[model samples]
Target: MISQVRSELTRYLRTETVGGAILLIAAATALLWVNSPWGDSYFTMTETVLPIAPLHLDLTLADWTKDGLLAIFFFVAGLELKRELVVGELADPKRAALPIIAALGGVATPALIAFVVGFGTDGMDRGWAIPVATDIAFALAVLAMTGSRIPASARVFLLSLAVVDDLVAIVLIAVLFTSAVSLLWLLAAAACFGGWALAQHRRISSPVIYVPLALIAWYALHEAGIHPTLAGVGLGLLTRVRPDEREDQAPATRLEHLIQPISAGLCVPLFALFASGVPLDGKVFGQLFTDRLSLAIILGLLLGKTIGIFGISWLAIRLGIAERPADLGHRDMFALSVLGAIGFTVSLLVAELALADVGDGSAVELAKAAVLVTSMAASLIGSALLLRRGRVHRARHEARALQPEE
Candidate 1:
């Protein structure tokens, strides 16, 4: 039985696309089950306190997932983002422009729209920033199941765009969301970052050397009024392996490879399980549709994302800043843009920040419900459209290929 379980685990891990999908499914199921008749137990399970020596640490299962497990996800994300900036498509200014432009436009337009809609409401206006994040796991999963049919360039474009989106989201979280400023704690955090840098300079690649420093950095940031997870970004940027002088080889490539599986395989899956399970019960249904925050999120993610990505992309192509991707014309881009509307994880994180301790406690719940609903709708609609378009495009290409006489 142990051997059988090991074999199954190996298979599940091997299929990255399937693994992501399964994780998402598990999250949704957990949410539904917990919100249903078993909700009391589910709620209790999350709220149950787990203890360590001399420290009374309290968390709901949800907090453990978000505050703890999701940090690992962000760490992995930081790793990937760094690698791309250093060596991948994003490394090249020319190649990176199209996606960077689209991502910026995508982010800017949505926030603008949200602000307009939520105008005159002081902090409620702040929530516009929440819809700006694109959940990379969900996006990648959508792309992956579509298989090799997508142009490699489009996939690269989407990945780069999402990375930029995450960057923007991080900045907004740090600047806009933070309420209190603790100078001493921030100084300590800086000291921890400096120590982490020193260790990296000495080429200490083991996670052990970094882990204690990371913990300190996290605690410091927590105290310093910055969200603790941003420490992952700090730790990632500071640590590095030297670049290979040989053009044929990569410097940080191995490190990236080493951490990616852990990030994608374990950390991300756990995050999906933890971050995603909102109690989607009958009570949630009323709040999901009518709440101002919920309405704004749903519309922003569904309408704002689709329009922003596609609209800006078209303008860039028209203005000659970018050429239409060789295999993808406007129609294809539109379909993908809709898929980009699937905002899940980052949206949740932003909602948590936006509604932190705000009145009625219902705003955050409503936002989560909106995220869950709109993201699912966006994914389904986007997938159906892409599959149809891909089929047609494939048929056309195959016909051209077969027409040898021409």
Candidate 2:
């Protein structure tokens, strides 16, 4: 059972690593498209509005990428979270406490830092949530590249931390960023979720039944003024985690296997393509440096994330509230904490949401640029640290292997 779980995790990591590479390429393409001669076309394409008046749905291409495509990504995330909680590392209370505590610390510290840095600055304080996110795919890609020699326990810990971080980000999006609430639509969404739970309880396995229900729930949430992507999480959590006696596979696991590829390969990269394209002009460049919002974001991600994650994790171990994995040393933990600083996908989403009503597009553009710059720097610095740690770990392994038999 343990080996099977490990194999599944390895497979998932490999898929995410490849997806991260594609995401980077997509982001680069967006940057290039925005800076090229056809820059106006890129903006035009994303800003083009499409409406389905009958359904009362009206959104731009960029909005669809964020609200529609990213739901697939969050659905996979919810599956992983449920798996961890139900049968994986987080199933054990003692084992779960570390990453859960670490995740909370990670979120709180960055948010606090952003708030402090942007305090009293116009339109800047709203972006406190931006630095609180950790991009799992991108961070995992860095780990795959630099820390392959590290133990599987490190990967497990990182995955757990990232999952919890995403959950917090989702809550922040639902609560802090929501503009208004329509109680009727909210109740309708609740009914859809209840129906979803009922279907799962009855072991109804037909997509024909569930898919439309999911769409209705998503639409209801959109109408309720909450981020509709949350419907994905709701449906995913309602999925059955225990294997049927006959099939020996949980519904959550099965659905994850089917949908993960779509989320990682298509939805995420598409979202990045639309989200990362910011027009670069001299004015934007100047704003990137001078703007309080940008500076708060950069510092919050680069410095605050590392400090918060590492500090809280250390405190947890020191206080006997959590125990570090035996295979991971203090050095490895610190290195992983540094990697946690890579806040790209969700951070970009938060920046857009937080600053949407604040100013002209320039502030949003600057915020996006800050996220790009900080995430890149975090990737480089964290990768270098992990590479150094990996080499040390490999050397230790080799020395032990070379030792004479007892």
Candidate 3:
């Protein structure tokens, strides 16, 4: 029995979705622990002072995870964006149209809904971008809970949609979220991108060589009124090697593979732990059912996300622009569409941006609480529906197989 149980545990661990599940669990655990009676200690530990060189950087341990560790997360996101543009789904326009179109609708609808909900409010309007994100880790966790039930195309569709979602989220952060604009520094960043492009064109093989220049670019953008992280995307986009005529490519794919493990294993999880820490105490629970930003976020994810994703997807299929996977029908798509709102990671990132210049942490905390609640609810409902749908699909298939004559 012990050997059998160990073997089963090993099999579960080997599953692709299991890692995502573990990450979500870790995030939830961190949130719970940080909000408990030991919460003050948790806060202190995260906020403890640490110095690097002459500059002393002090942040709650959470801030380090958010600002410091999340750089690596964005770096990996940059890598993924590069890969998708080069050789993955985003490479070909024809194949990419469906998800891209659906993603646009998905992103736009949520933002619009958020704005509509917060219309009369002053500062709350800035948080329009909060609900427009889809957390890939949580979404993947939803998919993985299905075991073998989810079709390959559905999985691909979800991933492709998320790629486009991430793209839009990046643009929103760079454009709408930033306060001031610095033309001179922006020009310098542009020049750095141009240089990186030239190196990629010339088959430059040194990642080390780009480090200082990238940092310079980062500083330029940071000073230029753009978020420093946008530079990561810009640098990634500029330096990424396209899979064209060259026989031996430079550092693109190799760098991507090397970074994926770090991103998935450490950076992302740490980000999750930091980002997910919304103190869910008595006051927070009260706000969950009443606060405008919280209500907007919750309703946007619960109602708008499903409508946005499924509504656009239905239109696409109706217009013959795209079709669902063979193993997936409208019912299955609805099930999957519900999961689209599990916007934990991306929502938190956007929340950070939305609440950047606002009142200290209140808006961020409200957004986090909403995201946490709605995303958890979406994941649970979506998972249950998909599992049942999968079982029904299997039963119908088996019944047809057993039929002697039609």
lDDT (10s digit) by residue, model 3, range 241-268: 4444554443555565566556666777
RMSD of each: 5.6, 1.2, 5.9
State, as a TM-score between 0 and 1, how close model 2 is to the true structure.
Answer: 0.97
Model 1 residue runs over 4 Å out of place are 1-19, 51-59, 120-123, 245-252, 281-283
Candidate structures ordered by lDDT, highest first: 2, 3, 1
**What is the lDDT of every predicted structure here?**
0.73, 0.89, 0.74
Highest TM-score, which number?
2
User: Considering summed lDDT, which 10 consecutive residues are worst modelled in model 2?
Assistant: 1-10
* TM-score for all models, in order of appearance: 0.88, 0.97, 0.87
lDDT of 1 by residue, 258-377 (tens): 665666666666666565557666778886776666777777888888899899999998998976766886888888788778887788888877876767766776777788789889
Model 2 residue 162 CA deviation in Å = 0.3
Off by over 4 Å in 2: none
- For residues 1-406, what per-residue lDDT tens digits would candidate 2 score against the true structure? 5665666678788989989988999999999999999999999999999988999788999999999988889989988888888888888999999999989989999898889988877666568999999999999988988889888888889989999999999999988877789999999999999998999889888999899889999999999999999999988888887777776778887898899988889999999999999877888788777878888998888888889888999999999999998689999999999989999999999999888877677778888999998888888988888888888999999999999999
The 10-residue segment with the lowest total lDDT in model 3: 4-13
